[model samples]
Target: MNHEFSVAEVMTTQGGTMCQYTEMTDAARKRVRAMHNWRRSQLALGNVQNGRNNYNCSQAANMYKMKYDCDLEKSALDYAKQCTLTPSVAYNQGENVHVGPLENDKTKAIATVGEKCTHWSTVIRSSEKKGYPGKTVNSTFFQAVKAWWGQIFRNGVNQRMIFLQNLRDKPNAPIAWSQMAWALSTRIGCAVVNCQSNTFTVCRYRQE
Candidate 1:
């Protein structure tokens, strides 16, 4: 859930002096896996938000570099070494290079458009009904939250449902909203799907 970036480096200290070094460690490898997972999740979310086939890794890397002021190559190499040593971690090195800002911005723009489209669609639906307008209102609000939950929870429907139920029943009930909100949340709860599509289809779309 945390996407904020920091420079990842290997360091060694000798003669009371600290020097930056690059080496792979089990902990560092774990961090790399975590970072890559976070990045992939962001990309998946971006694609879903944009209704697109996939997101460019180069663009994502560029965004990370710009936002965090870290060298992509060093980070990537470090990550790759970790992946190589760690049997559970598998990644395509060629697909992970960072490109720059323009592509990142375009990706964000596409995602924004998708978000706006969903918002407008919800508003229109809500406005068309009157009875228990409260329910419609609650449904609308919940729907948005559910969409977010869908992304955050990924394919875990049972987990999402359990989380939703817990939220609704929490003592403070921070989620307390109109019936419309509940309706919206219900819609979102029902929207879960596999995030990854066929690689060949994605490549072909990119070619076009």
Candidate 2:
């Protein structure tokens, strides 16, 4: 039997495959939640407290104003909101599934979805970019995320902290569309998200 994948199963010149979008949102939410979880931690530790924390406390209650939600801290709650509220399924579908967004929609989508799409291949080459001392390109999802994390997260965030923070119990940011394509090409697969001008960056999270 000669079984063949449909248009949605394979990536094309147009954009990301259906599976890629699914992976995109999934990876994105986890990552953001993880960020919030750690940010909350930093607040508790008084690391980012600016002038607070004369005394050292390792937990949130002792450090924060005690703003609690069903036992979770404001940061954790906020993390939940971000994950729940953010768009999960990519907007377009079917033959137009791989279609990229229009130039104008780039900013709007960024605001609404908190994530924008782009090509995964470009970002993969980043291993060769400056600040990335890795001798070779084409890194793994973890490595790619590590390299781009600094660029995406700056406010005094360092490479060491990125790895250290995820150790806590929170979901990491979601895998982006572009990253999704390369990260699991042989698996669920990927394709162009839309045919409109590639105005968006694949799976880029908005800063602040």
- List the candidate 1 regions with Cα displacement exceeding 4 Å: 1-22, 39-48, 51-93, 99-208
Stretch of 10 with least lDDT, candidate 2? 92-101
Model 1, residue 56: C-alpha shift (Å): 15
For residues 8-43, could you state the per-residue lDDT of candidate 2 as single tens digits?
111112322322232123232343334434444554
What is the C-alpha local distance difference test score of each model?
A: 0.22, 0.24
Taking all chains together, each candidate's TM-score versus the true structure is 0.18, 0.21
| lDDT score, candidate 1 | 0.22
Best by lDDT: 2
RMSD (CA, Å), candidate 1 to true, equals 22.1
